[model samples]
Target: MGASQPGGPSLPQERRLVTAIPGPKSVELMERRNKAVARGVSTTLPVFVTRSGGGVVEDVDGNSLIDFGSGIAVTSVGNSAEAVVRRATEQLQRFTHTCFMVTPYDSYVAVAEQLNELTPGDHEKRTALFNSGAEAVENAVKIARAYTKRTAVVVFDHGYHGRTNLTMALTAKNMPYKESFGPFAPEVYRVPVAYPFRWLTGAENCADEAAAAAIDAVTKQIGAHNVAAVVIEPILGEGGFIEPAKGFLPKIVEFCRENGIVFVADEIQTGFCRTGEWFACDDEGIVPDLITTAKGIAGGLPLAAVTGRAEIMDAAHAGGLGGTYGGNPVACAAALGAIETMRAHDLNGAAQRIGEVMKGRLNTIAEKNPAIGEVRGRGAMIAIELVKPGTKEPAADYAGAIAKACHAEGLLVLTAGTYGNVLRFLPPLVMPEHLLVEGLDILEKAIAQVTA
Candidate 1:
């Protein structure tokens, strides 16, 4: 979708429900899915979306539900974004699949150039494209390991990387994501994250303590020389959008530098202006050795990348990094259009506007609902932690109930965190003001209902 011409009809902004949520058509599809699909796979929401655009998902049931999850923050530009669709369709018309490793395309090179220019860090950089966030993270690890000639990788508690074997080792949560899928990749260690609201120590000491504890773990267990990289999300994504303390990131970077440990910023969820900035790591002014991104890249097409210092990236010998679908021509085309759309419409500014509106509404809810313990996050990626009154213990039951209520009210929301007590809102940056406010109102009512 390119920019609108002089006077085309503006996109519709309201949710129009012509039938009950999960109406006849959706129910029929679910029945078919259960019979044909494997039961092992998991789903966050039940409604089957037939068409999506702007800020809403039109379910097969004919109910238009406001989308706050953005397909888990994938469709940043918007579902069926005109620019992305146009570019992708045009590219597809030319050719479907050529396999970059076999035959390269200019679009792939263009995408890599954009990542090198846009990603944080002013140093000379190079990028490698991949299939998913986990693939990118895995590739980053390969590069780090090859560069540093080390095997150990460290991750923080409550952090989520992905579901692959190595990433499963990096992820901290046990249930759902990693449950019953054990025997994960080895040489991975976990340390406590600076979770201020729930942490025992004051915010003043948490950052230093967390950093120290991690360094200690690396030194005592694996030794600094044996470690390849320390991976972290500047603003934890599924880990409740928890913002680390002021000095936390810098200390980590300093420690990494001293130990020659590659600091990998897992920007899969926090990249693409989702957190008010181009990358959340930029806010701290820390230059991670490597940055991993996906989800929003290519405007929902499967594309992920690892951008890092050229030397480190070059450590991988010939044919060391790449995938069959990595940098698919159509996906690259979509990414180019997505980047243009973000700049043309100033979606970053819109994300800040979204954050302000969401914060105001969630703070008001926290004031009235004792179950809400914290309202946190930056930009469009925001979350509210639920807890019992006068205690810091997570209230996952209340969070689940609230989510169910929101879905029933035609507002799609998602829950995350190790305890599953944090409700995260990841609405598209193109979301209309009124629709966003309406979703917030629904969220308030849902929380109130659950609390009552």
Candidate 2:
């Protein structure tokens, strides 16, 4: 038996494989998916999930795989959490979609109130609801531009905001995300980020130097006056779980504050106790002018929010800041339920425990494996950057081999980093400690077998 949280009954939290990774049933689903689904949409493990919760995803073939990726950090409170299921089910019976913009709803206001209270800082804040992380991010940019009436937005290297047109421009990657999707929004600038692992001078000098470079680029190249916002992921998400050097974030935040540029923290993947804190920015006590949230906000429902200084969030005209289905009553209910689960389970502390376990185990693995470059991140969001045996060069293929091996063993994991050489883990905060330990064991064994 695995640990259980009062947040509700979760899956057994065990890894059970009735057949191969992509068993016959999953293969049938895969065949169907290939025919109907767009080719642009790709599957990672290629198994159709029948059900999921706590720490495992039950595939169509009866294979219950340990879930290390919480549907890209969306199921942090755990799938079908009691409050979530109960509230969402209740809302479903009552009404599903009465757009907030048209009629408004109490649950939507309730969610905004929670976010205002939970997010970093005690300042008066306002929140606008949206449907996805991308939508929320784009809206954040718009709000910044509207409030400041500026044209340029500055981002950092290895930052990932979203897939929308403006967000694609905000994103630093090229191939998969922004390859052919050109004519992207203008005035988006990319700057250097303090990446301690990859910094040329060394980790000791990373914070000061990177911050200087970033600040220099902003002032000299983009001119802070023209910059509407400076968007950054406190810990790089898709670009690898690269936590900026201890002092880097504060410097940037200070710079934006001094220069009148809005500091927008893209907390979509790092918020909601996923990072041990309510928001990653809270770790450094660096409060952003605007914060974007999604993924784990509403249990498994699609919901996103942008909470910020009231003046900035309210700058947009009333009719300008909403969508047809933004903050659907059902989704708002789910968000409230998800928040209840977070509080009930003390998921923040659970994330801290996950970080302790994952980092300790991965660091131990790194001590023995020369190919494992660096083990870094906070809370439940962690990653190991793969590199050549003796150098900092990314070992992309090595990462792929390791991930493939884990998948073969019924352990689902995801890879990230601009070089595609990082194995990122975003386990549910309610995941059983046994599952966490076992997942690390599988990862360690995979590394050994690959090197063998």
Candidate 3:
């Protein structure tokens, strides 16, 4: 066991491969999973985890792999942070579930108060809890439509909201997310995003030109007046860790304000200190009319929230926004614990430090490898785009090969991007600096071996 925190469980921090990638125990579990689990439910790494803490996940076969994905940015304070475990355990011992809609709980109210205080704007905000990021996003749209009395909603290119019917229509990607599952919700509009690397006009004009084009599309096609909300991921997550051009967000927010369109920030992946700030929008000082959160909100618990200005949120009738398990007491307790851990450990600052270490190391790797097209993102949410040598053409195969190599070598990494050519890193904020450097070292070797 590794050194224990004040009240947290201690797991070994070092990476140790006791057997081939998927040891016999994991192989047995894989067989069981194939028989019991649905094919639609996929996994990045197939190894079955027995214990995980800090920066490492130990599989059933005793292989401790460095966790770089953070369960897709869900465990910012590590898998078993002391505060989270303590509060959640206490809540579990007591009453577990009492639907907040039927009998409201203090923990749910407390979590709401925290979100209102933490989210960007301070103009008397309100919050509604949900079960997942998709639910929060769907509810945010509901609130926006109710408040605006309009039907059309606008989403950007390379943006990912969720997998729900409405969010599927809102999402930009097609292959796995939206393929063969169409018949999506109507009145949803798609527009170009300020993607600097892929912008045909050049990176310099990406921010201004993309914003102008998107605004024009809304004005001409959707007629702004018919649009209820302009929902965006400040730092695109599953669509790729594509950070929009610096000034693009402000421009879009300004346009939404002028058009009376509610600006919604789907910070599901980039919120709660994942982006070195409370929310990615803070980097640009963009105050969204509504904000959706989930992944890291409750220390791995299934909890999500939609927070916004009181006036807009109150537009919905009393019973318009809630579910049976919307704010389960146990999950609310976990959220409170997670928030406490974030504040106590300064995970926001930790994310910034992680970014500094990752970017510095990855940039050096990029300089040596021509396949590395660009290294972008802020704080702990960073990624490297792979491309054909000497050209911008995406090298998705190369990215996949590198990710596989990293996994084989005991470093778990994930791939993203609309083209599937970007290697994204979302290490837990509590990860030790040494582990980060070691993981980067493994990544460098994997890149070298694959490229060679």
What TM-score would each prediction reach against the true structure? Answer: 0.97, 0.98, 0.98
How well is each residue in 338-413 modelled by candidate 2, as lDDT tens digits? Answer: 9998887789999999999999999999999999999999999999999989999999998999999999998999
For candidate 1, lDDT tens digit of each residue in 347-430?
888889999999998998788877889999999999999998778889999889999989888899999988999999999888
Over 12-79, each residue of candidate 3 has an lDDT whose tens digit, in order, gives 67889889998899999999999999999998889999888888889999999998999999988888
Candidate 3 residue 324 C-alpha distance from true site, Å: 0.8
The worst-scoring run of ten residues by lDDT in candidate 1 lies at 1-10
TM-score, predicted candidate 1 vs. hidden true structure: 0.97
Residue 408 accuracy (lDDT) in model 2 = 91
Scanning candidate 3 in windows of ten residues, the lowest lDDT window is: 1-10
| Clashes within 3 Å, all models in order | 2, 0, 0
**Model 2 reaches what TM-score against the true structure?**
0.98
lDDT of 3: 0.92
Error of 3 at 25 (Å): 0.7
lDDT of each: 0.87, 0.91, 0.92
